[model samples]
Target chain A: MNPLLSARKVSFGYGAGDVLRDVSIDLHPGEVTILLGPNGSGKSTLIRILSGVLPSRAGEVLLCGRPPRGYPRREMARLLSVVGQDPPVDFPMTVESFVALGRFPHQGFFGETTPEDRERVRQALAETDLYGLRDRTLSTISAGERQRATVARAIAQGARVMLLDEPTAFLDIRHRVAFYEIVTRMKEACGIAALVASHDLSLCAEYGERIILLAEGTVASQGTPVEVLTPGNVQAAYGLAVSCDRNPATGAIRVTPLRGMPAKNR
Target chain B: MTPRARSEDGRLRPGPVFVLLGFALAASMALSASTGPVAIPPREFLDALLHGGAGTPARVLLSLRLPRAFLGLLVGGALATSGVAFQALLRNPLADPYILGVSGGAAVGALTVALFLSAGASPLLPLCAFFGAALSALAVFLLARRKSGVSPERLILMGVVVGAFLNAVIMLMVTLSPPGRIPGALYWLMGDLGLGTPRRVAVLLPYVAAGVVLLFLLSRGLDLLLLGEQAAFQTGLSVERVKTATYLTASLLAGSVVAVSGLIGFVGLIVPHGARALVGSGHRRLLPAAFLLGGAFLVLSDVIARTASPSGELPVGAVTALAGAPFFLYLLRRNGGKS
Candidate 1:
């Protein structure tokens, strides 16, 4: 089967320099693709391109076999959703209303929330464990809860593919684990495709079906965690000396960085 | 829960709030029409309004107070709605109708017409003011645009810079003008609604109505924008189109009011925030509530402007600023000076 989302030789730049160079990747249905990169490695840029937030300078991005931009924005939103790095906190709106915003693409021009939309919003809130706090203002929620609220919004969007940029950055460990479990469940049960850009190698190693290690705007390696998280690839991408091992019981890849040599006196 | 939460959960629907405000506005308009220095009695006021009684009371009611009150209502509603649109479009709580320098541009336009065209009738000033406001609004929009798009921060900055420049131009025109024209120009700058004739209000009515309707249609989009631009975009909002449409509609609203009432400063700045504090942040409820509350607030202020002094009426703008500046500071401090 064809990938649900694909980027073909995509390139992007911000006036002065290229941020992503000839990068290509595919997100398959019922699979989790973890994009691993150090700071300034063009992970965010690639996600933005795929989500159609930023048009690629060169090359094409296809969502379900057609150009992402070919679809009307509302139609595009029905098929694809993105959870950004930071959730907006300035507005004083209830979590329920915030989550209901996900139903935008589905609603008519005036965009009134119907009973079905509310039901979806309620289900999304429950899935993210945020039902009890639905009435609370977003400003009053904790960072973890806020992240979940955004996740709930994406869930409520009912998109087939989700693109999350550092979604777990603000989440605590418990919530982070829950979030990954939810993602895993969605992939298995609903055949949802996800492309998550994250820094948490260990978490990605355990949950990610395929890992794409990016460095300097290029895909340095692509394969299973065991293949991509090799010490040599990690060093090449992140410029750090690391040891890679597999957990005996879980059979998950483990990465450990070695200490650097002491500086020599001048 | 908190008192705010209790209130939100309580029996304060947007429908009743609008009705209540509507009643309050009608009552205030009646009171304002009667309570000026001439002081037409309640019985006389009613008789004059209903039966068209012949006398000085009827003449004052028909000629001056009624027109002024109507102007106050339209201008107030226009400013407040404009404020709501600006605040939502820019996603800045501090954004007011005048934040984009449209008022300053209108002031410059009005001052120029007052100084240069001494032969122009009272009706010509608002037309000139509207032109000036539209020109400045377009300039700000152009200057704020970039390859990435118009960010709220850049828009606000451009507005401030353009406003300052317009103010300087207004001052230059004031200094260069004939000495006799200075007071009229100053009163206009200070926001006088005394010039609002029934004809002028009629002329400006359609633009304000159109702007309000356009903004009402876009209220849902504005609500989504509170989630930030990228989130708004990801949710299928054409952020650029929404931004452009909102800015222009808001400018038209503000400019229409400025053209008629000079620059009634505070109604636009405070009414929406006050309305939000009462109703929640949802624009569908907040915009209409702000409109009614704003109309009432300005009519009451105009009442004070006319009644405060025995010798000459205080400028309506002065009354608003007296209340608005303090409220503005309190809002800033309440937001911990961030807005």
Candidate 2:
């Protein structure tokens, strides 16, 4: 079976410095693959490259079996959907209206949303449990609910691949766990090859089948959470000495980085 | 659950009917006039419009008030549509035709013509102003365009800088001019609609009509653009192309209006907000509503200006700013002091 997205030696940056350099990764079908990295470690940059928002400075990227740019923009959008971090929109759209915008790639410029498009939006709202608050203004929603509304929008895109950037960064502990559950359910039921960029090691441990660790604009490790979420690896990238233990209550691994004296500065 | 949710096609059938109503409003406003310095009866106004404005009253209407009224409609519609486009392209609520250096450039050009040279009723100043407005808009675009595309914030920042600098240049030109032309230059800066002629209208109408049509068609793209650049692009939009087309169309519309009307302020800045209040931000509704409501509002303003002072006609710009300023403050207060 072919991977849904492939990157090889891809590099990119702003004028300041390199954000992602010579990075290669693959996202496969029917799996929840989390791109785990510390903050400012090119996770969002890699997502932009694969999603074709930012041009690669060097090397190549492919969506499905061919060069990503070879796909028409609409075709690419039909193939992939993305939910970005910090969902700060300044429009007056209601939650339902904003979600309806995800169907842009699937509809003609003037074409009204068909029955199918409406149904997709309805399903996404139902899945995200936002059906009750669909009429509420997006500005009125809590940050966590807004985050899930964004996820619901991606689902409405009806794409095969889903790239999410910091999906739970602003969520409280409860919503974080709830979001992970939703992620796993989406992976099984929709079979979308998901690449979620996150800094939370616990969320990766609980929900991610595979974790790709990005550090200093390159991939530091790629494997199961047990292999990549080691204290040594985390300390190497984050410059922090950390201890890992299993939480008896939830049966999930937890990472605790030491504070004062910077814990020997890694 | 509202029983299967609202369907898209099942919405808003009364759209075209409203457009027709708007046309009737504009026509009635145009035909309904009073006996003043240039007295023309209402019946004669219609007769002149249908037949030829060859009779005394008809000729007076054709030559003066007719052009003035039509210029108000064209300028109002053009400015409002341009405002809508600018707000969408920049994704900023405060942007308007004047926000982008077009007005400053046109002011400079008109001042130069009024101060440095002597002219008859030849429409030379407005032509110069048109070129100046177009050039300033082009400068804004060029300064903002970088590697991938023009950033909205960069475009707006550049427009503000360019506009301020252009105003400085106009000030220098005026200061350096002969003292005799100072009053003329000052009058030119204040912006009056009397500079309009039927021929200027002929030139200005096509650009405004074409721009409004093109922009109305691209209304959906504009709506998508409010999502910011990356989101807009990821949703299958050709952001660069859309941005260029919209900027070109908007600048032309705004430029032509300023060329003829001489820096009419506040109409474009406020009309879109009013329309959005009535019709919502969906551009399909907002565009036409803005056009009609803007035209109606400006015509009424012009009438008030005509009737305001007994000694002489006040500048349309002064009148507009006065009428629109207090209303803008009220809006700000009413909307919880936003913008």
Candidate 3:
């Protein structure tokens, strides 16, 4: 099957520095692709490029076989939604109203909310377990709830592909697991594709069907977790010595960095 | 599941609040019309409204008081709407046209036409003011634009710096001008509504209406903007387009008003906050409520400006500052000065 989203030879940079370089990746339908990278490793930049928030300075990005720029903003929004890292909740809007913003792409500038729109928002709220707190202001919600609220917004957009940048950064362990489960269920139930950028190696190993490891704006490796999470690859990508092992109970890859390694070797 | 006393779609019920504000606005207009230098009774006011005449009371009611009151309403509404748009665009609650230096730019435009060109009485004043406001807005955008985007902090800083420099220029012009022109310039600078005429209102109404309608149409986009530019972009909003549209429309609104009624302060800053307090932060509700509440507040302020002294009129700007500055301080204290 054709990839839902694809990037070819994509390169992006700020003045005097590059953030992403000659990076190419594809996200297939109904699959979870985790982008693993350390800080300042171009993960967020790549996600922005894919989401059409930033134009790639070099190369091309296609959404469903068409250039992203070819689509109108509203039309593109309906096809791909992005949950940014730690979106600011400046205005004191209720959780329900905030989620309803997702329906923007589906409606006209002054379009009245139809029954279907309401139903979609309701389903999103329920899916993200935010229905119980629909009336509460976003400022009053916990950090995990806020993250879920943003996810619910993306889900309500009814997009074919979802790009999430460090969505679990503020989420606790329980919510982190819950978030991945929600994404997994979304893929199974709706055939939604997700490209999640994260630094949590274990969580990505647990949830990702495909992992793309990035280091300094380039793809270091791309394969299954067992293939990409090897000691040598991890050490090379992160510039640190690390031991890689499989968890016996869950049979998942686990990476433990050797903290006492010499600076040069690390 | 337990039933809640909310709308089925979770929309805030705004019917009662709108009706109440509408009534308050009508009542304020009536009160403003009835009491002025010459206090006309309600019966006479109604008679003057129904039957046009050339009598003194009829002229005052029809030609002067009625048009001035409506002008107040329009200017107030325009300022308030601009405030809402600017605040949303900048993602800062403290942002308003005057605070962002749009008004200062407009004042310079109007002052230049008035002092040097002697075009104050002509129809060119509003056009000049509009261009001035637009230029100032462009300057702010250019100064605030960074590699990433315009941050709220940088926008405010550039606005204040530019605004201060413009204010200095205005003061210099006032000092250098002929003494006879100083009073008029100072009064205009301080924001007087006495210049209101049916003709000026007719000229300005379309621009103000257009700005307000455009903002109302983009209310949904404005709501998305509250999530910050990045999230707004992800949500299908063209962030740059929306920001540009909002700034230009808001500047148009403020410039039109400033052309007619000099730099009236506080209506823009205070009305949006008041409206938000009444209705929730959703721009759909907030914009209309701000328009209404702002109209009422300005009419009342104009009333105070007319009647505050037995001898002469106070600048409406001064009256608004008297009331608005205290409330602004209180808001700052409440928000812990984060804005």
- Worst-scoring 10-residue span by lDDT in model 1 chain B: B2-11
lDDT of 1 by residue, B1-339 (tens): 324423332225666677888999999998888876576888888889889878998889988889888888888998999989888876777677576788888777767777777533355666677678778978887899998787666776898899889988977887887777655667767788787667877767787788899999999899888888888989899888998888878877887677666767868888997787667787878888888899899999988998898898899999999999898777656666443
DockQ of all candidate complexes? 0.55, 0.37, 0.62
Between candidates 2 and 3, the DockQ winner = 3
> What's the true lDDT of residue B240 in model 3?
85
Candidate 1 per-residue lDDT over residues A1-266, each given as its tens digit: 78999999999998879899889898999999999999999988898889888899999999998888788889999999999855555557878778888999999978877888978987899989998888788888898899999999999999999999888998889989899998998899889999999988888999999999999999999999988999788877887777888877788998877877332221
Q: Please report, in order, the local distance difference test score of every candidate based on alpha carbons.
A: 0.83, 0.76, 0.85
Q: Considering only N, C-alpha and C atoms within 3 Å, which residue pairs clash in candidate 3?
A: none
Quote fnat for model 2: 0.33
TM-score of 2: 0.84
Q: After superposition, how far is residue A176 of candidate 2 from its true place, in Å?
A: 3.0
Per-residue lDDT tens digits for candidate 3, residues B41-147, read 76777788988766688889887888888888999999999999988988777677887889999888877877777644456777788878888978887998998
TM-score of 1: 0.91
Worst 10 residues of 3 chain A by lDDT: A85-94
For model 3, what is the error of residue A70's alpha carbon versus the real structure, in angstroms, after optimal superposition?
A: 2.5
Lowest lDDT 10-residue stretch of candidate 2 chain A? A85-94
TM-score ranking, best first: 3, 1, 2
